[model samples]
Target: MRLILRNDLRKLMFALLLLAASFGHAGATPPPKEDQIILALIQRVEARTDLVFVRNGSDHNATEAAKHLRSKYKYFKVELIDAEDFIERCGSRSELTRKPYQVRTAGGAVRDAGDFLREELRALRAN
Candidate 1:
């Protein structure tokens, strides 16, 4: 009877180990490379105080632009998988306001948010 009990314990331990191993792979997969690039671009865009973005037919500073994008992202109804989706649905324009956001760079150059982000992504992909 003791030997049988020991055998049952070993089987239980082995089952537990298998269960743990299965759970390890169940966690979310890492975000794609483009997502990382997009996040970095968002951070950089957020940090720049000089850049201006037009939203809702009004001008917003860099911080406000970042905040707006983050808000859009959070309240977004759909699952955002990549930077393209975020840029299209949130960063590029206001769905409610119907205004496309434009970014004014530090050098006094103005660009559409989508174009600017695509440019940034291109540069990053090049490296």
Candidate 2:
């Protein structure tokens, strides 16, 4: 009878531990809501461009910039907290090329990626 009681107590303790762990997990914060949206915006920017971007003071096409951003996402050094952070750290410049990115729009207007994305981010926030 004592052995059975001990076993039951052990099982009860295990169940309590599991319950506590589950509660802890439930209380943890979820990932930011803007990660996927920012990625899609990058793709949109890539698709909309028809001219060259100045990367490290040289011209690069939209495809190249998009590819570079994708690669950065693959091996991110830290967690991306939001869309703005992702744009500032990943999409606005090229770490590998050590340069700020500038896009030349289809109409031949050159704009810095940071400025362009800030406007885009504002639009997104509004909607």
Candidate 3:
């Protein structure tokens, strides 16, 4: 009986080890940076935008995200524009877009949803 119990315990331990190994890859949590959040939001545009950033100024959260993503993912094209530049291009506006991105949802605007966030980064991030 003792031998049987020991075997059962070993099996349980082995199962636990396998479970832990599977979960190990998920152990590393990403940092809570603004750029990371922006990237996460822009996740919707992944198929279209390898890296499309619509932020104002030389320094901003999107820039920071681009820098970080550059370190991690090499196969991306980072594009940056002034917040105003995006609003001019798109008429509709979200709080993120001080200019406006609130135009009729169609065609090129729909195609460039990732570019829609340029104003969002400005309102949300510094520089």
Candidate 4:
């Protein structure tokens, strides 16, 4: 009877191990590569305090721009297949007014936000 009980205990342990392994695989998966790139681009925006983000007709600081981009990313995540798609869809222009987004450097130079982010993305990929 003791030997039979030991065998049962081993079987139970094996079953538990299998259950744990299955759960590990079923747990939350990491974001896709493009999503990671998009997130990195947003981080870059947040880090660059020397730049001003212009959307529509208003200027925003880096933090505000990053926040807005995050909101847009969540809204357009399903449609984005790559970092470029994210730049074009969420970072490039105002959906409401069709106005292109702009970025102003500390030196007072202005450029399209999409182009800026594309350059950043290229740098990230190179690294």
Q: What is the lDDT of residue 66 in candidate 1?
A: 75
Higher-scoring candidate on lDDT, 1 or 2: 1
- Residue-level lDDT tens digits of model 1 in 1-127: 9999999999999999999978752433326675576667677678778778877668888788777776776665245656766677777777877677888767778788888877766766678
Q: Write the per-residue lDDT of candidate 2 for residues 8-103, one digit (tens) a residue.
A: 999999999998977753333225557666777667667756767677787777787777777776555254656776777776887777578888
For each candidate, the alpha-carbon lDDT, in order, equals 0.72, 0.72, 0.39, 0.89
Runs of candidate 1 exceeding 4 Å displacement? 1-35, 105-109
Highest lDDT against the true fold, candidate: 4
Q: How much lDDT does candidate 3 score?
A: 0.39
Clashes of each: 0, 0, 10, 0
Residue pairs in steric clash, candidate 4? none
| Deviation from native of the Cα of residue 32 in model 3, angstroms | 9.9
Please give the RMSD to the true structure for each candidate, in Å: 8.9, 8.3, 14.3, 10.1
Return the lDDT, model 2, position 2: 100
- Candidate 2, run of 10 with poorest lDDT: 24-33
**What is the Cα-based TM-score of model 1?**
0.62
TM-score of each: 0.62, 0.63, 0.27, 0.75
Q: Which of candidates 1 and 3 reaches a greater TM-score?
A: 1
